[model samples]
Target: MTQRFEYDVVVVGGGPAGSSAAYEAAKNGVKVALLEKEETIAETVRTSGVTWIQNIKEFGIPDDCFNPIRNFSFCSPNNEVTISDTVPRAAVLDVRKTYRWLAEQAKNQGADIFT
Candidate 1:
């Protein structure tokens, strides 16, 4: 027999946006399912970068998934830019691991995840 599944909301992609949607929906008592085209979440890091510290906390991303950054520097042929803070307000995420973490968060929130 073929198994059939249904959900109130279906989200495609296991990336941040899709995962977030599914997570929020699940948190609000909605039956949601998250689907990823890749065999695994974050199977490849296409676009990844730095983000604010508050986002990390809001997303409940673990410390192990990011490296806190307190400084930034940029250089060009005619100019150089430097910025620093004693307290870290931003972080560089480990893309692959962080993506997996996001999926896990959605799962924990009661959303079904299908890779």
Candidate 2:
């Protein structure tokens, strides 16, 4: 026999957007479910994982999940330049870990996550 489930809100995918939506909905007392096609959210990587440091701080991203990028380089046929800063303006994240963290947040908020 097949099992059936129902929810007030059903979110597709397990990416940041879906997880965030589910989390917020559940926090407001709505029954929410998040569906992910992947067997595991971190199994297949798809994101470039580059983001600003300000975003990291605002989102409360863990320090161990990302690498700070304090320098950047750009090159062209005739000109090339490299810029460096004492503090990191941006960072490169471990996409898998980030996604898992967001999903976990949603789950903790009472959102049912299905992978």
Q: Candidate 2 at residue 11, lDDT?
A: 98
Window of ten residues with lowest summed lDDT in model 2: 38-47
Q: Give a tens-digit lDDT track for model 1, residues 18-94.
A: 98899899999999999998889988678866889899998888999999998899999999999999999999999
Q: Candidate 2: deviation at residue 11, Å?
A: 0.2
- Candidate 1 RMSD to the real structure: 1.5
Best by lDDT: 1
Which runs of model 1 end up more than 4 angstroms from their true locations?
none
23-92, model 2: which lDDT tens digit per residue? 7899899999999999987777777999998998787778988999988999999999999999998999
**Candidate 2: what lDDT?**
0.89
Model 2 bad stretches (over 4 Å): none
Cα miss at 52, model 2 (Å)?
Answer: 0.7
